[model samples]
Target: MATGWAGDGAVQDQIDATVKDGIQRARSRLPSGPGLSHCEECEAAIPEARRRAIPGVRVCVACQEARDRDAAFCGYNRRGSKDSQLR
Candidate 1:
């Protein structure tokens, strides 16, 4: 499908870009170090079971879910073409 001046592959390009963006976002959210038995964001004590269950966990489950929701809503902007830049 054509998109703007792009040819048949334009839609595929957009899909690829979107998938790449999602993968990047997921990778960015991954914890880098060992799990803490406390919430990194609020300092609330993380349950001992949680730490054991999810090694390398950084933030508490609640904090992590909230952050993920925020990220999901902050969708990508794909209209940064040269034409837009010139305006």
Candidate 2:
């Protein structure tokens, strides 16, 4: 099937690109190595229980929640379509 566009599988191509981008972003944020004794962001000591539970933990619970809230508001450019760009 064709979308009447330049390519026969343009829709699939777009979907693949979106998925790849999301995967890349997720991989980049993952923590590396062993868990820290203290929170990287707030300098508070990370609990022993938390370190044991999450092996590669970086931030403590409070700091992680704040960081997540901040990340949620970041802008994304999903309007890859030409029609959306014109508006």
Candidate 3:
């Protein structure tokens, strides 16, 4: 049953974790409710089009971009496998 060097169930575990993470990520991106008129982060005006389009957008495009950029550089790795930690 073991295919990889990690042993039996390791690959399956990794696949399960990846699928769970994907589901969580997708859920997080789901729209919540009515959109806010302003950006919660920067207090910038949220355009009507964006609000209507997104349905629950809390941050303006610029603020959201900045947040995404910071998040990318924050080094918060969600996939912290034990094998990686041992290395």
Candidate 4:
């Protein structure tokens, strides 16, 4: 039973929605097709080993790391999360 303004199974609905959003976000970020020879963000040449390791890598390690760091801070925090409190 939901409390106050929330409908039935509201908490579970939020949880499911969160998981679905995460899946879609991850899929959207996946690289597809032929990757560029250099980092798209920094224009640094991609190493042969790195290219072989990650088939569709488009950015160099440093740029990719920076992107991941940025992505980490941009997601929403769930209710009651400590990160949400910090915001």
Candidate that scores best on lDDT:
4
| lDDT of predicted model 3 | 0.77
Looking at candidate 4, what is the lDDT of residue 60? 97
Off by over 4 Å in 3: 1-24, 72-87
Candidate 1 lDDT at 71 equals 69
Please tell me which model should have the higher TM-score, number 1 or number 2: 2
TM-score of 4: 0.51
TM-score of every candidate relative to the true structure: 0.52, 0.58, 0.51, 0.51
Note the Cα lDDT for every prediction shown.
Answer: 0.74, 0.77, 0.77, 0.79
Error of 4 at 19 (Å): 2.2
List of clashing residue pairs for candidate 3:
none
Tens digit per residue, CA lDDT, model 3, 1-87: 444366677767777977887778867876788779988988889999999888788999998888778875322447676567345
Displacement of the residue 71 alpha carbon in candidate 4, Å: 5.8
Candidate numbers sorted by TM-score from highest down: 2, 1, 3, 4
Give the C-alpha lDDT of model 4: 0.79
Top-TM-score candidate index: 2
Looking at candidate 2, the ten consecutive residues that score lowest on lDDT are: 1-10
- In candidate 1, clashing pairs total 0
Q: Give the alpha carbon lDDT tens digit for every residue of 1-87 in model 4.
A: 456777788768877878898999888878877778899989999999988877788999999888888875467745667443334
Q: How large is the C-alpha RMSD of every model relative to the true structure? A: 5.1, 4.0, 4.7, 5.6
- Residue pairs whose backbone atoms clash in candidate 2: none
* Model 1 lDDT per residue over 1-87, tens place: 465666677667766887898899878866766888788798988888877777788778789888878864665567466455334
